[model samples]
Target: MTIRDTVIRTLAHTNWRLALPALVLTCGSLIVQAASEDPEVVVPTASPTTAAINPAGVVTPAPGTAADAASGVVKAPIAAVAPPTAPQAPAPVDEPLMKLPVNARHMLVIDDTGRVLMAKDADTVVPIASLTKLMTAMVVLDAGQDMNEEIRIEDADVDRLKHSRSRVRVGATMTREAALELALISSENRAASALARHFPGGLAAYEAAVAAKIRALGLTHTSLADPTGLSPANTSTAAEVARIAAAAARYPAIARISSDKSSAVEINGRPRELRNTNHLVGAKGWDIRLSKTGYTEEAGRCLAMRMKSGGQTITVILLDADGSAQRLRDAAAIRKSLAKIAAA
Candidate 1:
């Protein structure tokens, strides 16, 4: 062939090759759109046993091909192109570490050395309901009152502010020791009020002593209006309440009477059984050295405990929990979080 004829043949082949892909793509798109718009029309997909297409865009059936044997029609495989992906949201900045799973409105966990391990709103002052008995017991013990001396619960001992129910009736009489147990363990309001009334100089003197004891403990955010803790005016911060737990833990009677699971004492000439207000005191898996629980409409649920965990004495103060179960759950969550920290 002449050189011009050979060049013309090569140009025609190149143009055909370039046009073939566009023709195939257009046909495939039309087939897909047709199948979608009219479901009755079947779009044949390539089968492994069908004839294959060559670079020249012609179907060449291999030996024993089903499509070649059945008919002259053979489908070409559609090119697989992935759909464009959406831009990701910058991978979320690695997400700041999750906070502890404590739900108490005020929470504080401190080591024996008074180092705060975790806290939330610990400095906010809030009403501390029956926890006032801890201070009452402390001041009464500090005064060196005769624990065996008999004190009778009177009408004055009846809680008028909250009108809280109590098993320790107004006519009941018990030793100061029994009264202390009733106050701290059962959270008996009348028993607590009787103890304050029988103080060396009565309720006024007891209030003065509580103020002095608060100052002595170096607590900056604690105030008590009554010994029974029924008044909403009795308030303290979670941090200061932890301090109070620590101070109260120092007293052997306060620790023992408060932590005792149950105590039997003579009242109204009959033996009465009083169980602790804080159920965790003797509960399994707990090593509570001292425990106190408090509640009121204004205070919600409050808990204070000096307990041993991971071989370290910890003071856990949870204030303003919604319920008893929630307070206990918050304590358990704290323990679990502490365990994770210890392991880490």
Candidate 2:
């Protein structure tokens, strides 16, 4: 018989409606089973760069997705989602750009525009020793006295307060210019006292002039008890000392005299050579524009310098170091740091 005739004959012996419902259920289950076993079928998953919104109403864009890019959001490329790199190390505590090893108890470094480059305890007041000669020289120069006039180094010029010995003797006489050279170059106490004593109105007038200059320079933290700086009372902060150095640099005579590595002058009618207290003044690779060195029991070793490096003007002040060697090392360290900073 034909297939249609045979199927009709079998259905005639059963309930066709109940059999139709069973057939529909069996077909649905077979289709689901077939789909689960299919090898080529792929189920969609969530994107790795899915957008997320926090409770604070901030929406983080889904990166590396075309939907985000279509909405004007910055989309990172697929190749840009690289594995995180290791963190870099922090700079050392003594980074040259910010800090350096320094031995002085107080220091201040600045540029020509008075912008501070480095500082440590620079605002604290301390005895300045013979750094006072810079002010003394300024006062003497401001008065416009005869630099060629001979000034006798009397007994009053002797260091009674400190009992400090001097190469310029009590009976010795030298020109005011020579005395200034000795005072600044060699830090001669007798020479400084004689310059002040020979002031137009004497030492008292010289003190007044210093006070005026301090006011003029706006150096509130500086005080001068004596022109020679032999008195422990002669004191200033490193910041104020820097201001004094800048003012001294403006005077042609002070700048010229203080920077001299050595000067030949006749003392007691005998010619003698005076060497600069600052050894760096004539040292190789040191472009020192102005330099001064000072020391005392209370002040320790002190140095102030205006230097040029890499076409920049740098002023360095060191105070209360343990010794001259330590002071010079600190200065050298600072110079090296400046060179690095300039190079970078």
Candidate 3:
């Protein structure tokens, strides 16, 4: 049976409630489908010449006709039928695209030479969350501020909670160096704000300097809307963030703080052991020089790092990963791809 008839019959077999609407919609859909399938219609070409008529209205034979002493009566030009079009290769099935977990948005792994090894939506700008502390650390170090100077955490520093995790207590006093360490190792938001406040011209100047530093690093795709990665507005691409991590790794202090799995810091006049959020620091087969872990509702469990793999130095950035485990899997996939390439 014709497709149209088949659809009509199928609709008739359904219950009235569904049948009526189904039939109407199916009819329109079938019409469109059939129209698309119809072959192109070619118009017939004209004959080279036609018979002439005398004044007496008598028909004169054309040059190619038998009466003209050439051939039989002129044949009507045939419409040139296109050889039935070769059946189109069935359109590709359009296999479903891979879907990442909710926590991860963009991820990348790169060689030390800045070659991208593997990436997923790496260029899409999303919040870096607490990863912003890397830039804060860089800016603080760049300012050449006295790390040894003691800085007191004022009530103002503790006032803006922003609901982020912190190791800095409101009344604690600590060395600038220790505070910086706590910020990087523990993702301490309060310490970061205190450092920004202590910048050469205070927080305002610090914010400006962060932008300037991003420009200096040629990170066109990254921006610092806040000292801490607390603001969802603080966004950066995986590539740009990898570069930031690479630069951050050069500082002995940053390396020292980031690689330490745990360190003791005095909080509220009591010693509290703060651990590195990046589990890969001491994990087997990972030579992590510097690393940080970040997560926010807007920015899923994110990580950025510099490490040695297969005797080659590399950097990795994973943003909005599904879970902590998936980030590790993504990193492993990158290493495997690189290994295969190297073997080739």
Candidate 4:
């Protein structure tokens, strides 16, 4: 082996190695150029400008218009809507009747149309006591005399009970209207008897008028022996008393006068404020249109009312209750029953 032969073999090996590296560098340069020319990928330049590219590789605003300098309008993300709040539960109702400590002997409730809603011995006759004054006022109103006419209290008007309350003294003069007001509002026995005595046909015919009115109103279980219910003979049932309340409600004046809780009237030429015996008229929960309360040893405590409850009109009559508290409780019981029925 000479030196020349050794050099030629080495040079050929070196050329083979250089040819492989040159081929790899050419392929890499071509790949990079191709990627740069692709329209989908855009490289940002040094100029203070942004390009808008759609999803499909389309460029907008042609690179130099006002839109190219201004930022694109960004769509705001939608906010999630909140669900509605849950409905609240109804408030609990208190039962006033359940708090009463006494029981009543007879009770009844009727609709404004005279249809019975509830009854407990409603048809059994019981002494009506002072409830007779309701019919007495009805008789006086029917007598066709001027309400402003004056009448003098006589000895007959005074109650035999020495300590009993009275608005009129013997020989004192008061108008018919004032007397009727005192009679209905305060349950004044003297005013009632005075009105009866001054009726067109006097006391006897006045009693007849009361009976006739009871008959005309179709109150079959009612009987009247006196203008004031002081006479134990004046007796009626709860059903009949409810009918009387309905009939009285027909007369606006009677209804207005009966429901008045308090009023000022002249007695013996002085102003006397008369308070109603029926507490339901002035009670907070009652919308009383007509009302009357009665009490006697024979009748106990009695109450009748035309009232609105639970958006419906009703008549309530409580007879021979043990006390005033019991009569009020009876009324509250009927109201509670009606409310329950309405809710159902």
Best TM-score among the predictions, by candidate number: 2
Q: What is the TM-score of each candidate against the true structure?
A: 0.71, 0.72, 0.67, 0.68
Better of 2 and 4 by TM-score: 2
Residue range 290-335, candidate 3, lDDT tens digits: 8888887788789988777767777777888777787777666665
- Prediction 1 TM-score vs. true: 0.71
lDDT of every predicted structure (CA atoms): 0.76, 0.78, 0.70, 0.71
Instruction: List candidate 3 stretches off by more than 4 Å.
Output: 1-103, 159-161, 267-270, 336-344
Query: Candidates 1 and 4: which is better by lDDT?
Result: 1
RMSD of each: 24.3, 22.7, 22.5, 32.9
Worst 10 residues of 3 by lDDT: 91-100
lDDT of each residue in 1-344, candidate 2, tens digit only: 44445456546876887667655665666677778879977543222232222332112222234343223222234455678999765322223534465789888777665555566667678999999999999899889998888889898888888788888767888888889889889899999999999999987888899899888777777889999888889999877788788778888888887788888888767888988889888798888889889999999999988899879878888999999999999999888988987787
User: Compared to the true structure, candidate 3 yields what TM-score?
Assistant: 0.67
Q: How many residue pairs in model 1 have overlapping backbones?
A: 0
Task: Indicate whether candidate 1 or candidate 2 has the larger lDDT.
Answer: 2
* lDDT digits (tens) for residues 1-344 of candidate 1: 44345445555777867766655665666666656989676554333222232232122222333332223222344568889889653211101112454567877666765554555666678899988889999899999988899989899988778778888766778899988888888998898889999999988898899999888776777889999888999999876787788778878999888888898988876899988888787888788889899999999999998888877888888888999999988888777766665565
Q: How accurate is candidate 4 locally (lDDT)?
A: 0.71
